[model samples]
Target: MGAIGSSADNAAAKSFNAAFKRETLKGQKGWPSEREARLDAFHWLTRYNTRRRHSRLGQRSPIAYKNALPSTTIALTQAA
Candidate 1:
């Protein structure tokens, strides 16, 4: 889980759980079937990685941060 701090992370987890339930779980909190939840989870995971805005990263989403960085740094890295 790409969670943050302790208390805040718990709250965030609950938020995602609810979002997952509504968007993917279809309102069922418990899994009547195992793999269905897994499938839903995988889909949400994709969105979380590619779509969510992360505050710690200065509002840039994960995909945005990854793409914005230089792929290969020079000796400037050491100087910094």
Candidate 2:
């Protein structure tokens, strides 16, 4: 936990931002409009969550790992 308004409170989000910049935004030509940017972000996020293999999840994409888990485990996690 971190104090309100502290950068530490956003450490995880910052890491994700860095990765998104590196993987999606950096070295790319800028979007022509806000709507284009929004659409690109949505596409990238969908690919990241459903297709990208995360090392922390044993090289499984998030959706794959979640789908592989037992129904009871999913239920318990959602209940929490």
Candidate 3:
């Protein structure tokens, strides 16, 4: 986390990051443009979040990991 500025980049250090990069760069060498990159990145993120397995998650996909989260809600008040 120290080397990277964003928490999201830090979180990307996990095992799932390997699978994500491999799948994205498998067929195409590189993206054509900003829009193309965005589209491809979105598609990969969706697939990874829904289907990629994780040993730390007891071999469950990230989607499963999220779905298993306890449903709790917290109300927020505006600062007026």
Candidate 4:
């Protein structure tokens, strides 16, 4: 994407890691099981993508943003 060791290239990743640490990890030293950790991350990611409000998205979740868009499907054939 950018030149070697570019800050811009890592900006998004850094933001994500910070949020993950703050929200998912919640300062916990460790999980009781590896499966539990994975599941927790999965749940947090799902919630973040579907319910978390993002400023860049006009304070809407990704699912809400998508639902707000107008349909663009072209009609291929008339329905009976």
Q: In candidate 3, list every pair of residues with a backbone clash.
A: none
Checking candidate 1 for backbone clashes, the offending pairs are none
Model 2 accuracy (lDDT, Cα): 0.86
lDDT of 3: 0.79
lDDT of 3 at 13: 70
Against the true structure, whose lDDT is highest? 4
Per-candidate TM-score against the hidden true structure: 0.52, 0.69, 0.51, 0.82
Q: How many Å off is the CA of 11 in candidate 2?
A: 1.9
As a TM-score, model 4 comes out at 0.82
Greater-lDDT candidate between 1 and 4: 4
lDDT of 4 by residue, 1-80 (tens): 45678868777878898998798778898789999999999999999989999999999999999999998989798789
The models' CA-based lDDT, in order, is 0.77, 0.86, 0.79, 0.89
Please report, as a residue range, the 10-residue window in candidate 2 with the lowest summed lDDT.
71-80
Per-residue alpha-carbon lDDT of candidate 3 for residues 1-80, written as tens digits (9 for 90 to 100): 43567656666576466776677778777887989889988998887678978787999998888899999999999899
As a TM-score, model 3 comes out at: 0.51
Give the poorly placed runs of model 4, Cα more than 4 Å off. 76-80
Evaluate residue 38 in candidate 2 and report its C-alpha lDDT on the 0 to 100 scale. 92
At residue 75, candidate 1 shows an lDDT of: 62
The alpha-carbon RMSD values of the candidates against the true structure, listed in the order shown, are: 6.1, 5.7, 5.9, 3.5
